[model samples]
Target: MFGLQACAKAPTAAADAAKPAAAAQDDGGYPLVTDVRLQNAGNDDGWLMYRRDYGSSGYAPFDTVNAGNVAQLKQAWDYTSEFDMGHEAPPVVNGDYMFITTPKNHLLAFQASTGKLLWKYEHDLSNAGLKTVCCDVVNRGVALYQDKVYMATLDNHVVALDAKTGKVAWNEKIHEQDVGYAMTLAPLVVKGKVIVGVSGGEYGARGYVTALDAATGKEAWKQHTIPMPDEPGGDTWPKGAAETGGGAAWLTGSYDAETDTLFWGVGNPGPWLATLRPGDNLYTDSVIAMDPATGKIKWHYQYTPNDTWDYDGTNETVFTDIDYKGAKHKAIVSASRNGWFYAIDRTDGKLIYAEKFATATSVTGPDANGKMQTDPALRPTVDKEVFTCPSFLGGKNWWPISVSPQTGLAYVPTLHSCMTIKGAEVSYKAGLPFLGESFLVKRDPAFPNQWGSVQAIDVNTGKQAWTFPSELPWNSGMLSTAGGLLFSGSADGYLYAFDAKTGKVLWKSPQMTSGVLGVPSTWKVGGKQYVGVWAGWGGASPIWGGEMAQDPKVKGIPLGGHLYVFSL
Candidate 1:
């Protein structure tokens, strides 16, 4: 009931993102993805959900095709979706079945080893949906439960489908699409509940996360990212400002079964002009740890208080134990969009160590109490334009970071750019963009001319170990393996396999049809390990990236929706 409170327009949404199944080959049996099985999925040879496990590490345990044989990798199979827009999903596989989602909520199932299309679910979106999504129409991936495949659509829908037939099972509306609310992150299925987060903060929509009953599609629990008047942290926002204060929980969160905690990242505050709402803005740019069953918030940590540069803290939280100050502590690490990397004590929400991984000038540093201290002179105002680092697209964004148990390092796809931002006067209208600011992405002369790179951070010390720079913004998600190999794609259309310990590129795939915006995943079928990634040139960097998008090297990248699988 704590949804949009702005008095402007009516809003509503649908339940499902599927329909009549488009048959391909014979549909296979459903892959049983139980809560227990998913609990140990990080050690499994399959990918059951987004980022493969509750850790949300974007890593797999397969080692058959690794650094030793990566150079011999050859195309094993390939498939293309009918629709093309930012193809952000990882090639998710369970048993011998592979599931992938394309833009506009299309989910396709295939015979894992042979690339034979099994069944396709083409979701039809209303024309009104075009006005909802703030970024490209992208679906990260699908969730595989016992007998169902789950997807959260861009039209603010939570849908369940028959895993074997791609037939619609149940569909439930999360919010009114017209209210500027949409769901792009893949549904996280935990203990019979389908959890999803809302986006569209730019449109002034209040953000929240909902958990639908996996069997019936009924909402079990819901929690708004922005605190209410009587709720905890409500004092952070003044008067009625909390109603439209955007703390969009835009990314799928990491789960810790050991403590029964769900660590979700809250995005930026709305109306970009921070002075308009005042206070630390509560949970806006922070991570909230909650109970998975009842949606009760336990502890929260803020990354950038009163964020005005659009530096959303909605990055995947990777769980790992880090050694700091001569002691080993369990932590959750996030490479925040505000240009800082943080490792917080997962148990108590205390800062263990905070480090700068990119060129940043917006903040002075973290204070004794761990609050991020900003450069007051750099605050963007209507009369004063200020230049900042790590542009709004982030030092790193929702592309996801993978932590490797083998390397004891987190592999991050880093974007290096800055912005010149200025505040503007704006008012909220139902389903309309609410950002009260103007900005342009640009290069920072203080850093190298490179726009992106893949940096490996030493978890123990919270220091960057090595960097693999790119000519273009590295938008692809990173995937690490037990074989001591790290895999990631390029905006130039090649997939490279690097030695996880060193930053040496051991193997690079031939150029594909377009730049890569998809995350890479690996799984085993019939005892053979295979690597897969989607080739498509579309994402926020090219859309919101102003002058940077017009760079000579970035101008000609083609659009596509091809899923390519490789094997040694």
Candidate 2:
């Protein structure tokens, strides 16, 4: 047995709206999931995946709770997780059961309509995985296939659980923990294959995404993000540099079902020192579009070439159709840690528009080839310390961006910060951090008083619509809806709803147990739409936010986790 039935909490929120959801649950169980259903998550009633759809839009087409009645939103129910390190998992819903993962790979199942606990599966972990975790011990969430719930554990094992009984179906070890590889991504399942990536770029692990048979848990194919000595990108690096070149695909990627393509973002190159290996690193700090069936690279677009500031391109690439300059485009966008909001033509992987969404001052040009030109002087060096905007924590880190097709704007969870960085000498070890750079996170010089913002950008125009400033880093993931509402959370402990069009605060929930670091999601049950988000303060924020983390305002905030659901 992978799990022992857990105890439930009191004061459950009755599903007054369960009448409409009766049609969804066949036999009073989770609705049978299919590839077509996962592709149509935008039109569904449950928060299905990390972004709710293949596009990673994080937008739901529910209007029952719109901007008009948002102010009346109240807590429907809440659940406290077993572990409190970082509840970074969003509530992945299917029928009446919702799922979340706390730090340390503990999976919690819940009654979606109420706050009752269903079952909790505590993953068995070896101590080695915790040694090389670059950030906190966090698991993003889980993926639900036909009947199995899948999660990648911190020890690099992908476990498939019976969605109903919480029993272990199969557990596959993706990689050895001793080599410094770990799995924190929520598995992405499509066409019967579970796709997941590894995290250990800082530990010199060459990154890759593997596809497994969803039902059997057998390996299908694996494609590495960093190329080898004989590969096409071999010439881009020095001799043998590709061995630990560092292009970890650390986050869950977005998919385009129509194109049969998988878009995965590659992280920063090894050592964070351009002088170690020359040329534009082929896929590091780039987005690679691959064939889902074979894991073959179809097209790739580099965001920051020769990245030396730890500016990872490993942020989610969200798909949203947009009208740009009087022409409609099938576009994919990303709010990168480099502090740039980029809109790309998904069809051919070309840059449509790239605009600065936060404090960014290290690089400038994307030339005609869609390549970023790095500012040589601003880059950190062995002997020179350089101050740059959007620090390594990023203008935005792994916290996701949400795009609303209704408004044609991307709601960006942003960090208004900068850093002073310098290069350091590093040697590759089997299971050690290889970040050959030193950085001290600081406030953005342009906005000295503010550390973060909810930046809404017009995707079509590559222009800013509005921004909501914050006293602390707004590291929570964002959600947009057909309700004309934008939802996100704050480091100061409030879950906020803003008018998507004008950046106006529609509702702000009372302070929760801790800071909101998990992504916000929306699902409909009993015809009533509920907003779900987890609260916890562990990520790269407090761990890597140097000077800023020590500030009186950010220091000693809190450290715990809780799940909150709100409905009007």
Best by lDDT: 2
Tens-place lDDT digits, model 1, residues 1-568: 0111112112132111111122122234444677777787876666878898898888787888877888899887777666657889998887767788999888998766667777888877955546868789898989878778999988778889887779899989878776878888988888899889999778887778889999999999999999987999999999988888988988898889889999899999988898798889888999999999999999999999999988887899999887787898889998989878899999999988788998878866789988788888989987888988878898898899999988899998999899999989999887889988999999867656788999999988879999998878899999999888999999888899999999899998888877889999998865788899998888787789987899988877878777888887
Model 2 weakest 10-residue run by lDDT? 1-10
lDDT digits (tens) for residues 419-446 of candidate 2: 8999888888889888778889887889
Give the lowest summed-lDDT range of ten residues in model 1. 1-10
In model 1, what are the clashing residue pairs, if there are any?
12-176, 14-173, 15-171, 15-172, 15-173, 16-171
Per-model root-mean-square deviation over C-alphas: 8.3, 3.8
Clashes of each: 6, 1
Off by over 4 Å in 2: 1-28, 127-129
